[model samples]
Target: MAEESGGEKTEQPTPKKLQDAAKKGQIARSKDLGTAVVLIASAASLLIFGKMLAIAVLNIGQRLMRLDQKDIFEPNSMFTAWGDAGRELAAPLSGIFLLILVASFVGNTLLGGFNFSWEAAGPKASKMNPMQGFKRMFGLQALVELIKSILKVAVVVGVAYLLLKLFFMDIMALSLMSEPNNIESALYFLGWLFLGLCASVSIIAVVDAPYQLWNHTKQLKMSLQEIKDEHKNSEGSPETKGRIRRTQMQMSMKRMMQQVPTADVIVTNPTHYAVALKYDQGKFRAPVVVAKGVDEVAMHIRKIANEHKIPVLESPALARSIYYTTKLDHPIPEQLFAAVAQILAYVYQLKMYRKGKGSRPKSLAKDLPIPEDVRH
Candidate 1:
């Protein structure tokens, strides 16, 4: 249905989709791979530790066989003997089983890392529905499982048949051999058989692992509409983004207005542009534009400067240069330093004159040294 509405699932699953699926325990897994690894590990443990295990078992057997007629007659003695035999076998057996356990964990980790999810384990309505169950019973996965089972049975039976045929005389000779030698020979035969069986299962694992990975990727492939929906959900719609941008601009304008009253002077294009400059000898080596804007915002900055009694100067080239080249709360360029310094000097003089502390200062030059490169 998604394919019909949104085109084919041509794109690979995105990282978010893969992560979400893993959180739901939908990671790819190959049971055959894990089973083959455990079986091989078990075979290796048996081959390496067979002598130790044999010695342990032999000790228990000898202890049992050395029992007196009277000892067998007593139930308490029989229980004591069984307890001693269990203690003898425990160490070697535990080592072998622990190796196989570690192998099982490592095999599963090979593909999917380690992921567990209660959501995947929990009961679902689809799982309980009769129609769903019927479909699952005859699904492609079920058919594949059935074929694998048949292949495994065939392979094991064929190998067992060949091994028995090749070793028939040797097996018949086992009955005539002495006890220790017989046990050793039997272990040798069993180890070879176990290794052969593990090899057979490994073939199946090799085929199944790649198939499972490809099937997992196929299952998670997204249609165009799903990709579009995920994008929209994560990033928001165009209209919502536009509204957010407008709100941010309004808030920024308000903040810029708040900084206007703190400015040392306002340079204006007289109608179109206004740039508020501030300088402190201890804080900055050069003048910084505290606020800047055009048209209505320029008008607002001039009105705020008037209310605060901050100096307002009109120098269209200097204003245009600062407005175009400098960002708010950042130092003006080196090219504009001379022009800014002259304006600041004039402002200081104008302040002293207003307080009746000095003679009226000469007016600032009309042609401020605004470099052509910075004259926007």
Candidate 2:
């Protein structure tokens, strides 16, 4: 047996281990990936629908600003105008919210596929433990997260500075241009800055995703002893299984030996093989092999035949053929019919002579008519 200490985890986690972990809501997931994806998607949605959103906001502002004196004084008119403003904002706001929701879902799915686990949602005491909380806050994972956050901020700031330096002339010219032209130039600079930030975050996400998966795998690794215990729990323990097998074999042997008394003759390969055969013209067309065994079981078969006063014969070829070709309680093949018939006839003659009913027949034929194809 392989020995393993609990401290060293050497075995790869089995499928069952992974499945149980999943049931408990333990899975590899990259928060960085999800964050990056949501940021990119939100930026893209704004770029695509920014004009429509601006138009909606402008229309609501214009309606509110154009109210007559009577409309402003009347409480009913004020309420109606507020309701109109809400209705105008609803479609644009809902579209942006739905886009963010879908982007977050897609981002999470890309990292760990879809997983629904009630265990993750349920409250646990461990989460409230101060020591555990402290460990989590100051652990290697926390350190890695801190480094990532610093790197992301640094990269974004550096990129923004470079972008502003490259567009310094254009930016200064914006002051000399009209208001509309200045707004357009500012929007263009913001778009490029957002894209640069998204690109940097995406690079971090790509690296972090694989690292999270590797760390999860390492956490789930098992020791050799754990693997063996899991196997014993899933399948039965080896010692118990061995006992069951031995008991079954003993019962089978008892049944086989009981059938020996009914056999007409027990043929043997002198010491190695034993085959018990019986035939009745009115019942079986061919001789039936009642029992068969090898070595120790063969010796036991011969001992039972002697106690029952049943005839025993030495015919290695016939014994091997019957043992190999016939199953217990099944008829021998047609090829061995002639050889078995001769053995049965000789045994019957010997019984009759011993009872003083007739003289003994000639010695049984040594070269029984066994077919070449059926020989073991």
Candidate 3:
């Protein structure tokens, strides 16, 4: 006898498995989270170091061109220095910029699954169906976008105003001095202000980016009813389900009777029911249900048990209880504990008697009492 045994082998990953992965730190954030982190970092780096980087380039290019001391400060020479510096810095700076951009794009794509669908970019037929179009026109998503745009404008304007005020403070301090080293002092203050603005703007980007990403993902969750409808559509109707269940039961019965040769005993209703129990000292703490059957299945169970030289006993109540409650490879329930204990004791006594050791059973045998509520 053989069952369709494939169901046990194809294990499904349950929700608990996902939770365990998270608990073990095996989970990772989506690509959006990585993109947001990189963007905020880049914005900060540019804001703070832009002036310092420009000054460094200007100094290097002036030395390389060997500009005269007087010509260095002249308007024509200053414009030439700027153009030369930009040209000289282009290779290293452009390479760095391209690297950062590529890294950010790759990191974000990995964190977030590839969301390359064009339909997600704008309104579509399915999304516009009936009342959905009205909802989309005045939805929370639209409101959030409006707020984000307003906040971005406000932040940029405020940072610019603060930078101007800082510039004035540096200028006023310079005026109080007898001989102001104009270019050096101006560049130093500009560098400081640039760094400050960059730091502040980045703080804003860091907070806003993740919030926007989270809200976007939340809109993609499927509804419960949608899951149920998919399951029914993929499987079949109720009648087809019942037929599959009955076929599975028949296959299970065939496999169960095949294990009877390995059983130690069969407790039975003599005709209508059978339950085969197997036990070994240290192998099991109690008897295990190796097989069970009713009607035609019972006849097969009993026939196999007889052929295998295993003991078969008529115990209608125990057989029925085992059939209803104990599955193959499971222990009998607590309510049937006493009855099973008596059967085990009797079998052990018969083995001792056959060995010609004293026919007397263990004193603990008195402790085993059959339950009164057991029905025949």
Candidate 4:
């Protein structure tokens, strides 16, 4: 017969993985929409806020003229006036800018888990293939741009229509309010308009950025085969894992047998399994398995019990139960309570007999006896 040979396998990307990649900004960012929206918002805010500030400055100047009883319109004072206006507006503008920055950060994080990092922003190798370049130029990324454009247009038109309906009357009545007291009213209307516009624009900017980001991530979901391949790549082949597990079990068995000499008793399946247990008064109310093993290791455990003169008893059920349920230097579980109680009773009887106090108690005789195999 001829020997068979294995062939190499190739790994492929899954739809889910591709979708996730898209979400991570592997697809292009809708920079045009994002930039235009930010610029429009910043301009609108500055214009609306600047108008309100100008009205406040005028009102303040009128009050100052009444108090000082002088022409406060001197050229030298004009520079001071501009400085005062700027200083008065500084705090509000600073607060507004801070809010904008925070909103931008939150929007980005929600969309793609993206945070500003210098490394990712840096330049790297360029793709050399013409087909790859064409794909990059007009692929899913182009679709993202088209969607962003449509969304931006819809939002802008909606906001404009609402603003016209709500604030057109306010704009017309601005000059009709002439009293100095009405100055406050005029400024209040402007503030309301500014807030309404900001609230509207911010809603679009925040929503679309994250929505696109989420869509991108959805595109990167991994298929089952991709997940398996990734596992193999990261954890090595399954055969290697099995070998590692077997090696670990062997090491554990060696360590388990090494602790057998300290055991007070060795419970056994004669030649197949061994579980060595120990107890110290006032320390352990229940006995602890000091060592346990099977096959060659089981034989080594029995040999250690013999050398240490620890009594070994053949109880197939007890031996198998302890081996399967308990681990080295750990207490046996509750289900084997009666079986373990019998083993300990036998051990105690053997100790008493060796001390020459008396014969084995009737209770101990009825239970399994400790092995004559070990002296201690």
Candidate 5:
């Protein structure tokens, strides 16, 4: 159905997809590489410690065979004999086991590093589904695995045959020698045979490593829709992001409107722009823009200022400068200091006149000390 619907996987897998796959223990790893390493390690360990292992085995065999009838009849004596035999075999057996263990660890690490995932280890009912099991068994992946197994076995057998044929003369000559000489020669021949077999398997491992990685990557490939969905999941859906931005802007506007009522005076570009300013002689060194906006938000600021009875002044240059250059709750630029100071003084005097403490001040100067560069 997926194929019919054009859901073919054509896109490269994203980093997030790869990471998720790793978390599920679906990383590329070659079991053949591990098998080859173990085989080689085992062969090498035997070559290095074969003499010690032979001596230990001979000693244990002799001791068991030389046991007297009385020793066998007595339970304690029989137990003691078995314990001694175990001690004789312990060193060589432990060394071989350790070698194989280290080899397996190194081989696995070289491919995928260590990974732990409960999801991979846990049993699932889907695995027991007959259709699913049949699909898996007859899938392309299974076919590839079968072909690899066949090739590996055929290569190993061919190597063994060639090695035996090459050493056939030496093996034939071994029978002409004494028993001890013949045994030593046979052991040497077997070591070389083991090494040859390991070499053959290593070739398979080298080939299988890249094939495994390619297969794993192919399995993880994404379709166009899958890529789009993954990107949306990572970055947030467009509609959700747009809603968040709108909510933030609404909150900011509400906060700005709240600050407008506290402003000492409002500056306006008549209709387009409004900027509310506040200054405290003891608390603030300069007038700070309490609220500022253009268009609909400008009208909102002006309406809030009127409700609070804050003085409103028409200063197009000052309004534009404050609106463009200052942020809410931040002081106006040094270039606008003189012009702002004039406005503040006018407002202070007007307040005193309204309270009947002083005579009305002259109307604010038409040409306030606005800097040429400061005007937008």
Candidate 6:
């Protein structure tokens, strides 16, 4: 077995296994990817609407800082005044928050097939166990997380240093400069800095996303024994299916034997094969194979035909052709119609002559007019 011998999973997961995992919310996801996406999206939103947002924030700040004399003495007026200022800023604030929300959703759902399950969301005892926590700390996933954190910190520091170096003069000017326009410039500069930091950190997301997907697949891979067990569960045990098939074949043969006694004639290969045919002028356009068998089954059919007094004709070529080309209870192929018609005419003549209505017909010729394609 793939995994059972060495406890290593080697088989790819089946579709059913994937579905079961999805139901439990064991879906591949990278926290870093979601974080990067939100950060970048928020930065993009800021760059696009920086001036209007900055103006809104400044207007709200000024209104909040400069309290009215009546507002200072009366709490209701102060509350009303602050509410109006915050409401004016709400649109820009809502736009930024909404971008973050949408970006995170896109990033998380991008790699994994989307699945949400309460069972996965629910707390587990393993999460609370100190021993499990300790083991997790030393795990490969924990190591990867630590490395990612370090890389992110390094990226952030590097981007910040580069931004400050490029715009040191601009930063100094912002502090010394005047009100609204300087605020706009400052917000614009911060937007660029945030965008750069996030875009640079996204290198980790690019690496992490594929790794998380592969790791999730690795975790779910089946062993050979597991695949076998799952197959049995889904398709039923092979041994049981074999027994059922044998029983069905035996029942089918029993039914075929029952048909042998009712046949008009039994054509035979002398010892190897037997095919019992039936025909009725009003019921069929051609002869139908009622039953057929080989060797031991053929001998048994011959014994039954003898007991039932059905005519047994030993036309080896015709018998082999019917046995191979015809199906049980179905008319013979069109190519054999002439040959079978000859046999049926012979049987009819024999019957008539026995009732003394016509002269005894000549004994059936050994070689009937069998078509080349219908010949065995």
The best candidate by TM-score is 1
Q: Which residue runs of candidate 6 sit more than 4 Å off their true CA positions?
A: 1-28, 45-105, 115-130, 164-191, 213-245, 251-265, 278-290, 299-313, 327-331, 346-363
State the displacement of the C-alpha of residue 338, model 1, in Å, after optimal TM-score superposition.
2.4
Model 2 residue 175 CA deviation in Å:
6.7
lDDT of each: 0.90, 0.86, 0.65, 0.65, 0.87, 0.88
Point out the worst 10-residue segment of candidate 3 by lDDT: 1-10
Model 2 accuracy (lDDT, Cα) = 0.86
Q: After superposition, how far is residue 169 of candidate 1 from its true place, in Å?
A: 4.9
RMSD of 1: 3.7
Better of 1 and 2 by TM-score: 1
Off by over 4 Å in 4: 1-55, 59-83, 113-119, 127-225, 234-236, 315-328, 332-376
Q: Across residues 112-135, which tens digit of lDDT does each residue of candidate 3 receive?
A: 343443434555676659788778
Backbone clashes in each candidate structure, one number apiece? 0, 0, 5, 15, 0, 0
Model 1 bad stretches (over 4 Å): 1-11, 60-91, 166-185
lDDT of 4 by residue, 1-376 (tens): 1112111123344554555554433652434334445554555555556555556566557644653334454656656656776777676577557656765554445434554444445664556678888888789866866776687677767876787688778777877876553565565556665555555555655656656656544545444555777668768898999999999988887777777777889988889988888877688767898887788878888888888899988887668767877766677776666667887777888889889987965543333332332212
lDDT of 6 at 78: 71
* lDDT of candidate model 3 versus the reference: 0.65
State the lDDT of candidate 5 residue by residue for 1-376, as single tens digits. Answer: 8654447788778899988998988999999998899999988877776666767766776787896878857879867878988898788789988998999899887787888788989998999999999999999879988998899899999999999999999999998986455655676778788989998999989999998888889999989878888889888998999999999999998888899988999999989999999998799888888899998988888898889899999988889988989998888889889899899888999999999999999987777777778778
Question: Top model by lDDT, which number?
Answer: 1
TM-score, per-candidate, Cα-based: 0.84, 0.60, 0.48, 0.62, 0.71, 0.65
Against the true structure, candidate 4 reaches a TM-score of: 0.62
Estimate, for each residue in 3-64, the C-alpha lDDT of model 2 and write its tens digit. Answer: 43664797789999988998889988999899889888777766655555666666777878
Please give the distance, in angstroms, between residue 338's alpha carbon in candidate 3 and its true position after superposition: 5.0
Per-residue alpha-carbon lDDT of model 6 for 327-347, expressed as tens digits? 999999998887888888888
Candidate 1, residue 330: Cα displacement in angstroms equals: 2.5
Q: Identify the runs in model 2 with alpha carbons over 4 angstroms from their true place.
A: 1-7, 166-192, 239-376
Clashing pairs in 2: none
How many angstroms is residue 153 displaced in model 1 relative to the true structure, after the best TM-score fit? Answer: 1.3
Q: How close to the true structure is residue 183 of candidate 3, measured as C-alpha lDDT?
A: 41
